[model samples]
Target: MKLLLVEDDRSVATAVSAILTQHGFEVVHARTGGAALQALLSNGVDSFDVILLDVGLPDHDGYEVCGKIRRRTETPVIMVTARSDVRSRIHGLNRGADDYVVKPYNTGELIARIHAVSRRNVPPSGGEVRHESELQFGGVRIELTARRVSVAGTAVHLTRKEFDLLALLAQRPGIVFRREQIISEVWESRWDGAERTLEVHVASLRSKLRASALIEVVRGVGYRLRAPSA
Candidate 1:
């Protein structure tokens, strides 16, 4: 797979690039955020499978770069940073990163994370219905195929995770999805801190949907979607 390595530190980039190359990844090393963005934009649609973005970029913050990348493509981004704090992790995820890894990360673990995020982004295969590509319940409308949501006929913008959480719940309205199930489905991993991240995404979805009555909290169990009354 082709991968973009965005890091200003030459020694670190060289080491990581070597590891990735040994594993058969075609690594494109970019020393600055602008260079990375240029590489991404200049390449064809099938260019890069994943991006390893360092938070300490010389020209731009990783968070800003992540947002810009999201605006341009749905390619998976894994933020590589030394910021191990929960707030920083959440912030990176909120900014559209598929995953976050601290500096001094294990090469094996990093490779696994890269594969996990890429797998999650792949479109489902076979005859399964792409559930609710366009769904309308009461005044809320969801277009999963387009990744768009609207409430009371007004468009509502949501982060990537927020939309995924809502779409999962919307698939089976009124069924209480367990917290663990939600996390496994949405985040695609069983990270210890995933529960907290799930909570944050749920809260963000609720706020963006602006239809509190549509999402019901079942206390300690989990959350469920409430369809509009007929």
Candidate 2:
């Protein structure tokens, strides 16, 4: 797999790149945010399979870089930073990163996350779909083809993962979706680390939609969508 390593710390970049190379990943090292963006612009968005971006950069903040990247392409990005707080993690997600990794990360876990996000980048086959073009629950409308969501005619902005999670549950209302199933399908991972991320997205969705009753928690298992009464 080809990867773009966006890190200002040369030592960390060298060590990480070596490890990734040892694991068969072709690494393109970029020391600054502008350099990373230049690489992307010149090499094309599809050139890199994954981007490991450090939050600290000489030219731009990783969050800004992530936003810029999102505006250009749907390429997967994993924020690698020393900011270990929950707020930072959520902020990274809100800015359009596919995943977040703290500094001093476990190599195996990071690699797993890398593979997981890459897997999610692949569009799902139509075989397992609910075959619905759009799903509606009262004022909420989910457009699967357009990947758009709106509430009562006002457009509701959603990150990619948030939309995926909502689409999965909305497709089959009243059916309970287990946490593991949701994570595996939505994040394309069986990693335990993603459970917290899933919860964050759910909470964000509830707050954004302001329709608490639309998604009901099943206590121990998972979440179920409550279709509106006719």
Candidate 3:
């Protein structure tokens, strides 16, 4: 797969590019946000499978660049930066990043994230049985194909992770999904720190849906979707 690696630091870029190259990925290194944007624009939107964007860019903020890229294409973006704060992570996701990885990260973890995001973006193969593309429970409507959600005919915007979490629960209403399981399926990682991130995403979903009672917490276990009629 072809990947765009956006970082201003030459040494870091070289190391990451070499590692990704060793893993059989064709890496395109961009040392500035302007250059990265130009590369994408000139090469066409579908040129790259995934993009590893640095938050600290010389020409522009990584978040800003990510927003621009999202506007142009649906390619998955993984934010790579030194900012490990919760606020930073949340902000990056809200701005359209598919994943966030902190600096000094394990090479295995980074590769895993790349594969996870890539897999999620790809369509399913074979003629396997598929779930309904659209799911409706109470006033909530989830359009799986369009990746959209609505409440009482009003559209509700959600971050990628927030939508994934809600859609997973919506698929099997009333089924209690363990925290670890949810994190593993949604974030594609079992990192201990992801537990807190999952909780934050849940809280955000509840707030955005404006139906806190829609999702019930199963204390000490996990969470389940509760139909409004129930």
Candidate 4:
């Protein structure tokens, strides 16, 4: 797989690129946000399998780069930066990143996340109500077969996790899905940090749908998708 490493620091980029290359990835090193964008422009949209972007770029912030990438392609993006705060993570996800990995991360875990985001075809099956080929929540349309979503007749791009979360909620509208249940089904993990990731995806979904009330939050409990009215 081709992986793009966008980091201004040459030393860090070199190390990461070398490591990824050793792990059987074709690593492309980009030193700045502009260079990264240029790489994509030169190679076309589907050239790279995954992009590892740094937040503190010399030319443009990573979040800005991520947004630009989303407008062009659905390639998986993993924000790799020193900023580990919850706000920064949320901001990156909101900008359309597939995952967030803080600096000094474990090589094994980084590799795992790279593969996780790259495997976008797999769907999550939890203990929620089973869904058919399509589901509707007012103006939002979900195509489970194709893993596609649209809002008010307009196609909307959703990251892998975002689609999984929405699909889970839409399985049985009006059924309150517990937080643990969501993480287990959508993420297939019992990791403690997954709860926060769930929250970020939910916020992203709500914003993209433009129907704040479509997904009802059961405070101190979980969330449920509102069923269409008669």
Candidate 5:
């Protein structure tokens, strides 16, 4: 797979590029945000499978670069940063990065994240299945294909995880799900079975689904998607 690596630091860029190349990914290194934008507009955007972006660039921040790129393509983006704060991660995610990796991160872990995001963005291979275009509960309607939500026809933005969790719950309302089950359903099989991660995702879902109070915490049992009428 071809990958674009955008970082202003020369040493880091070279090191990461070499590592990715060793892993069999064709790497295009961009040292500045402007140059990165130019590369994408020229050829990288259409050709690359993934973009590894640095949050703090000499010319422009990664957030701006990510936003600009997203306007043009839905290519997967993974933000690379030295910052570890929750706010920074949230900011990167909100700006449209598919995933965020702290700098000084393990290369193997980074590669795993890249693969996971790439897999999620790809269209599923093979065959027909029962698919629903819209799911409705408690006056809320979620459009699965568009990844959108409407409460009484008013729009709302849900983070990717929140949307996935909500969609899973909406598919089987009143059926309780263990955290592990939900995690396995939403995340790919390669992900570590981390219950804390599931908890965080569920919390985010609850926050976004605030108008309906549709998600019910079941104490030690797990959680249930309860409609407002329930």
Candidate 6:
């Protein structure tokens, strides 16, 4: 698949390019945000299958570029950054990026994220999904169609994975889901790293819920959605 890589650091770019190329991807490298935008706009539909965007661009902030691209296209943008904080990840998702990866990322993990994002962006076939209206509990509502969550009439931002995890837990309420299961449902992949991703995502969800509580972690087991008020 053809990929647009927007990175200014030459050494880092070289390393990433080699890795991606080794994995059977034809990468179009761009050193500046302007050049990246130019390449994207100039190339036709089949030119690029995905974009690996560096958050710290020499010419412009990756978020700004992401916002612009989001306005024009539905191409998946996977953000690569050194910022590992949840806030940074949240910011990238808010700007329309499909996935986030920190700098010094594992090539395998990056590939997995790419595949997961690609799967998500794949348009649904034929007819549409006729599903439930929403999931409501403890003043929190999840709009399935809009893919949004609101707490007590206020919107609470959540990453795509976070929403998926929440939905899975919500569906079964008190039923515990193993970390491996959570990973499969949310990341669209099997267990890796002893389920650190599941743990991290749960922490993020807890933070978002703040005062309005739900979602419990069963020690040495898994997590379940249980009303905190209960």
Estimated TM-score per prediction? 0.54, 0.54, 0.55, 0.54, 0.54, 0.54
Q: Residues 174-205, candidate 6, lDDT per residue (tens digit)? A: 54555665777778787867477777888888
Off by over 4 Å in 2: 123-230
Which 10 consecutive residues of model 5 have the lowest summed lDDT? Answer: 122-131
Q: Kindly report which residue stretches of model 3 are placed more than 4 angstroms away from their true locations once superposed.
A: 123-230
True-structure Cα RMSD, model 4: 15.2
Candidate 1 vs candidate 4, lDDT winner: 4
Q: Give lDDT tens digits, candidate 3, residues 97-213.
A: 999999889886787688668657742232111268988778888899999999999999999989999987776565456676678888888858877897898899999888899
Q: After superposition, how far is residue 201 of candidate 5 from its true place, in Å?
A: 36
Q: Which candidate ranks first by lDDT, i.e. highest?
A: 3
Which clashing pairs does model 2 show?
A: none
Provide the overall lDDT of each model, using Cα atoms, as 2-decimal numbers: 0.79, 0.82, 0.83, 0.81, 0.76, 0.76
lDDT of 6: 0.76
Tens digits of per-residue lDDT for model 2, 57-175 = 98898999999988887778999999999999999999999999998998766866876687677423321224578877899999999999999989999999999999888765654
Candidate 2: what lDDT?
Answer: 0.82
- Backbone clash pairs for candidate 4 read none
| lDDT tens readout by residue for model 5, 1-230 | 66789988898988888766655467888888898888888883566678899999988988999999888778789999999999999999998999999968987668657656765664222211114798788778889999999877888888887888888767646645555456666785433657778778777766666653688876654566777887
